[model samples]
Target: MTPMLKHFRYLSTSGIPRPFRSIPGPLSLPLIGTLYKYFPVIGNYKFSKLHINGMKKYKQFGPVVKEEIVPGVNIVWLFDPKDIENMFRCEGKYPKRRSHLALEKYRLDRPNVYNTGGLLPTNGPEWWRLRKIFQKGLSSPLAVQQFIPGTDDIVTEFIERLSLIEGQNAIDFLPEISRLFLEMMCLSVFDIRMDSFSDNELYKNSRSTRLLKSALTTNSCILKLDNGPQLWRYFETPLYRKMKKAQKYMEEVAIDLLSLKMSIFKDRDENSSKSLLDVYFSYPELDFKDIIGITCDFLLAGMDTTSYTTSFLLYHLAINPRAQENLHKESVRLLPEWNSPVTKEVLAEAQYAKACLKESHRLRPISVGVGRVLDQTAVFSGYEVPEQTVIVTQNQVSCRLEQYFPRPNDFVPERWLKDTPLYRQGHPFLLLPFGHGARSCIARRLADQNMLILLIKLSRNYKIEWKGGRIDTKSLLINKPDGPILLKFERYQC
Candidate 1:
């Protein structure tokens, strides 16, 4: 049955959709739904603060509980894997993930800046079309592999740069790695050299740094305007205003760079060594504005997630010395020579290293879970959910649950080894950090390669140890270390 028809039937049979309303959830007060039931609202300023207590919601509400962020929007949190399977399967060829309402507003307000939708907010045929074109650019195995030599040099140079930080006073490691990722991303995606450590380098005024600064502003705006009060939609709040400025800066810079590149590439003949920009230039169907939009999305995602994940892996290794030792053994055996280049085939040999990265991801996921706005009504966990409801796969909660994993609290990378009885067989649906189906991250391979190379090199050169007691995670757009992660690194002696 159609979700709309089902909803209509339920409404006509009863004054309201009792089945929908009957779903277990927090108390919903008038306009704000059940937000006030768990959060604080002081005067004009109101904060749902979901990021700080996201897992708590799953605990307070059951496996399939209703949450109304505002009057119209209803979010259903599903921890059961069965329900997640249905939702993912129900998502048609072009999966519909959450659309950033604030970003949509920006696109509407400035048609010139955001002429066409990019991956983040685009859906249906438009999303599918752009996704295919985008896949050809980044997702293709050939695309990322073509740049391996460049990516390897970038990582090797970053390790050299990282080594310079040794013997210095205890320092916050997050910002340091964030820069490395940013530099690597720029080199890979834009064909831009962004090494600030080079004697002739200028970071503050460089195009890469400028893009990073503008992206930070735009991201902060999206988080506030996207997750903030619904009332912000009516007025131009300070955040929205800042978002406009940031987006404009981003658009202007992108158009200028893309236009200049197009002009430069216009004179050159077709060649096999085309960069991503070159690939886009080859496609006559793509609009200049769209090229800018896709590039912007690349810049946005490229900045944070991989760096955050790498930091967490390092942290896990530092805290769990046994895991670190195990990884060291694996690294030494697979890579007897520490300075070797990491190709996909070579990376496949480093089983323990991959397991360590996976363990860190399971423990500290970037988001609470993957979200899919359903287009069809489907049964989830024995309940009939209506259409257009945001179904969240709370893997962050499920990954740690003892029911799915034995001794879920312990950081055991060996649990991922194939021969062990602890190895899970068929739970891909339960543990998706980058999401699943067609909507999975386009940069999955690129990000994975980046993290693996950096970690392998890092472990080879130094023994990482966490001096500060238990660090917390903060979830905004990305889940990351809450504060400065103080860790001690010693040079490995022969």
Candidate 2:
């Protein structure tokens, strides 16, 4: 074992007090630190250097090793499931790190619901407040029930779109699925009909959406440098102008929707309990801009993540024909017909279908993991993590750990079954596809439900096979299939 791992193991077994165990690993460089090494190469591909190196570093340092990504930024990488649990329990004490370059660029000029704060990105008391408000909408059994029709409609539309692509045809599932999901998000959350697939104006002005989509995929030191005040001022070029224009387009779309929602709310009777926007507006003290920010947060978070995950699921299913058969069998047994809307009851019974999704997420999580900034100095194992230190748990790696999974590299849905030892010892925090802790994904239920429903519907209707008998996975902010997930769909005959 490496010194870092030895140190971590010692800390775990030793009865040392909190705040005393020194965090192990290398020191940061004066200014650029490891950023020059890690950031320069993370260009617009599927996986970040941080993620690639993080797994390598963990192998060398053990579960609780510390490393410097940049000067003064000490990142503690936690790989052990036990360590993950401890960190999650301490999450409120350790909130989300400040917005990074990409987030800042996106949010710098925008006004919407997140202006007040939302669950996935926000932290502190403000996050708690917004989460409470958002939870009321998401967690309400009635509200979730109400959302079913919209979700069903969108997923059905998505399957129909998939049907148009013939066998072995190379298609970019990224943009196509992104548009489908954005439509679903709007319909489900705001009762708004984006119909982006059909609307020319919406399609034409969606440059901001395109940019955001591209930003997530492309790698650039220039993009990173542009976020820094000093560097950004010195490098006022066309690329910067393009980003600014994109940001403006994004803001316009958000504001337009916010204004429309507000006008409708204004005209409605106080007693009308119709949409999520109406419910939110009922609370008179909350500002409209904040509402818009939070709503947009939902829109952005929901769209990219679900679409990317669904894409990954489709790719995996296309490649693994036996897994596809298992999924199809499960779907047929549970919801034999695809004509009806997928209900929670039907989804709950689709055991293998759910397992396939869980396994897919396990292998190719949207994010490598979530990051939490230490609110104050804290100790993990035998290390002192200073205040403002960024702590990241490798959920992707955890899913592959032998302690948590048997044959971690293989896709086996039966492994998640209740009687299995894997299920018994499974670490909730470690297996988080939606993350864990005080700032866990608020849209967890919605994202989960949507993915499962889409899978169930797709599997029942079509037998998905890969083009030329090969599949490739890629990583951006979210992991997805590299090429358009090319597939031949043989329609199921009833």
Candidate 3:
């Protein structure tokens, strides 16, 4: 073996002290860490073992375990809810741990949209400032209420499109739902419609959207391999060129939309009510580029997460018909009709539906977990985690711990029902689907409300079932069904 390979093998096998011995599960091979075992197994959708195997590791290694994949870096996998809370509590100081290879290769070259001051990517004061601004836009109860109609229209169209599918067909629901959700996000955030469903040049050939997807996909893969280039070289690559073009396209669209809105604002009577764009424009701190960055942030965040969660829920429901039956029955009893707005009370009443969503998220979080880098040396679980050490809190494993959840593997929504200890005692940090700390998703409430509306409408219209009595999941940025969710929709006889 080469000298570097020999060093990597020694670090993987013998660098750690006996007390911090390697956990009993998959064997870590020379220079490759656990990738050699995990990659092949997870590459197949039918036999993907990452989630299950990771959970097993947590059970064996306790809440905090260190794995030395390379000579200098030690990946500390944290599983306890308390530890997660502590990590998040240190938010600004403990910013997202930098991934040298992936971040440089895919993220740095991109214009600020993918790199925007939004919750997921930014750090320190910049992140806080953007989060504050976004929260102001998203927090207005009146503004959110105003968005309901637009969101409903989008979901209604989604239902209409789904109705056209033939009987007992296996179809991939990811792309369709993603497109619809992206449109909805655009409508709500920009107060303009892209109509992604109908062919439009902007929607069909959106260079920014395509580039954003590519960058995220490439980042995810390369980060896992730690094969990123140096900072200066990253900006000069072909990938970087694509990212820049995508950002430019996004900026052009944003500027045009902003100009149109500004004109309307000028034309309106002095007493006319302000829209979201009007409110956004009133803020002097934001420029055209900032606006474009935030807009792209909303689109990217909404599309992948909503579509993935929806797909995973469908996958679980497809496999567990009884859960689906219960959810449908609850949804029907609460809403009884699809034409009306879903009231807070009615949503609360759909206990099983909410449970199923939580259960799905617990099993398969869209991004898996959050990452943070220690700004100062800190001791965790009696081990000294030095400054700049990357801490990854595994949401999949943390949610499945028997202490926090009973029958974690099984599908049970009752855990979240009223008056239950599980409901009361569940740590908010542990149950974070939108992440935690100051950088959590700004559009979370809006997303949840829209999702609930879609579920109600879908349950009222169709009886979803698996094709050939089975469903499988595939991951490409977001976890989704390998094929579309196919079911027969009989018009509800009310």
Candidate 4:
């Protein structure tokens, strides 16, 4: 029997779907809700082990779990693909989801520096407006295609740098990948090469390192404040203060980059094609502060998402030699020579490469899942959920379950390819790496192009091997690798 048929054999959706109240989850008290369940000694769940906790919840609750995470704020977690589809379908024209409350508070506290809470936190009309402008040049395939040459240029330089440390015992590639993504994002968003890979004393203390450090600091701070109590809301907590300092540095750097780009725009020929930054600048709806906010948002969003995803992708390739060889075969077929320029046409034929990425995403998604606050009421698993209720889709859990993908724990890229016998025609919403719908990731195309080009180039050059312990994820607002990504890179011989 086929994997799809096998998947069907495990199906147990019997009887009528339970009501909203019947959705199983941990107990919730009046003021603290289910917050006590995560407290020390008394609590069963650990905030650091949220990903593990999600798996435990799935086993206990059987797909649909609802809990009031905080007082008066109830969240319905959907692990079933069918219910995930229902949740998204209920998302109206302006799909709304809860943002980083701490980040929003930070932005709102400083009205002069930020016009809105940026893209990740803002909702309603402001989000719609920003998203529309963001989609102008960043969303389209062709738009990202324009940067293929530039992205490949950065990747080629990075691969050459990797060659220097080829024979190292175990290379901690997370930092290496982080630097590569930073350079790529700089070239794509700012139309400038950060040259972060260059071994220069000046580069060490320059804007690139500073910006990356600030971003990391801010991410750590936000994670600490978001998961815990609302202590930051009451006063400037130490972590909050540190985040503000890092954010302040980020704001200064963004304004500087904006100024630099604007000055360059003044002298450039009108016939020259506009860059992503130029496209944002052209939008009259946004002012200077808004541009700064958007630039900062892109910087923050681009850094970790693609870099972390690439790290896991490489890890998957490292441990699974068979899969890596298959990818190497695909890369060798398309890229005849090392440092071959990755063009839009070449990427079109790299199906296996794309499948490898999809498989990696299935295993190590950047976030546990995407969440939404529906505009209208919807029925999920026959439960009549109310409007404006936050519905979090447990995609991380579902994607790994046998019910959706057969041999879900194994790294098998063939499952994503239709011609393979191992393929399962699973639910369309089973794997949402870039998410779905209008309110999905704004830089989805750009991130994909960036990583695809890098993967193709890397596979053609080196055979990745992992000789370390299993790397898992730790939830930090978003999912991040729990430990260092240690790998060995040996130059491939023809």
Q: Rate the local accuracy (lDDT) of all candidates.
A: 0.72, 0.66, 0.61, 0.83
Local accuracy of candidate 4 as per-residue lDDT tens digits, 44-163 = 887766667788898987777888877777788888888888777778788887857788898888898888898888888888988888888876788878888888888898888887
Model 1: pairs clashing at backbone N, Cα or C within 3 Å: none
Of the candidates shown, which would achieve the greatest lDDT relative to the real structure? 4
Tell me how many residue pairs clash in candidate 2. 20
Question: Highest TM-score: which candidate?
Answer: 4
Q: What lDDT score is found at residue 36 in candidate 4?
A: 90
List ranges where model 2 is wrong by over 4 Å. Answer: 1-13, 17-27, 39-47, 101-121, 140-142, 166-168, 199-243, 266-273, 419-424, 468-475
Ranking of all candidate structures by their TM-score, best first: 4, 1, 2, 3
Across 210-256, the per-residue lDDT of candidate 2 in tens digits comes to: 63454343322222432233344455455555555544555567678
Model 3, span 376-494: residue lDDT tens: 44445545456577777777667777778778777676677776555545777787777775556688777777777788777766777655444443533344455556544445556
RMSD of 3: 7.6
Q: TM-score of each candidate?
A: 0.89, 0.84, 0.78, 0.93
Clash totals, every prediction: 0, 20, 5, 0
What does candidate 1 score in Cα RMSD to the true structure? 4.2
lDDT of 1: 0.72
How many steric clashes does model 4 contain?
0
Stretches > 4 Å off in candidate 1: 1-18, 37-52, 196-210, 267-272
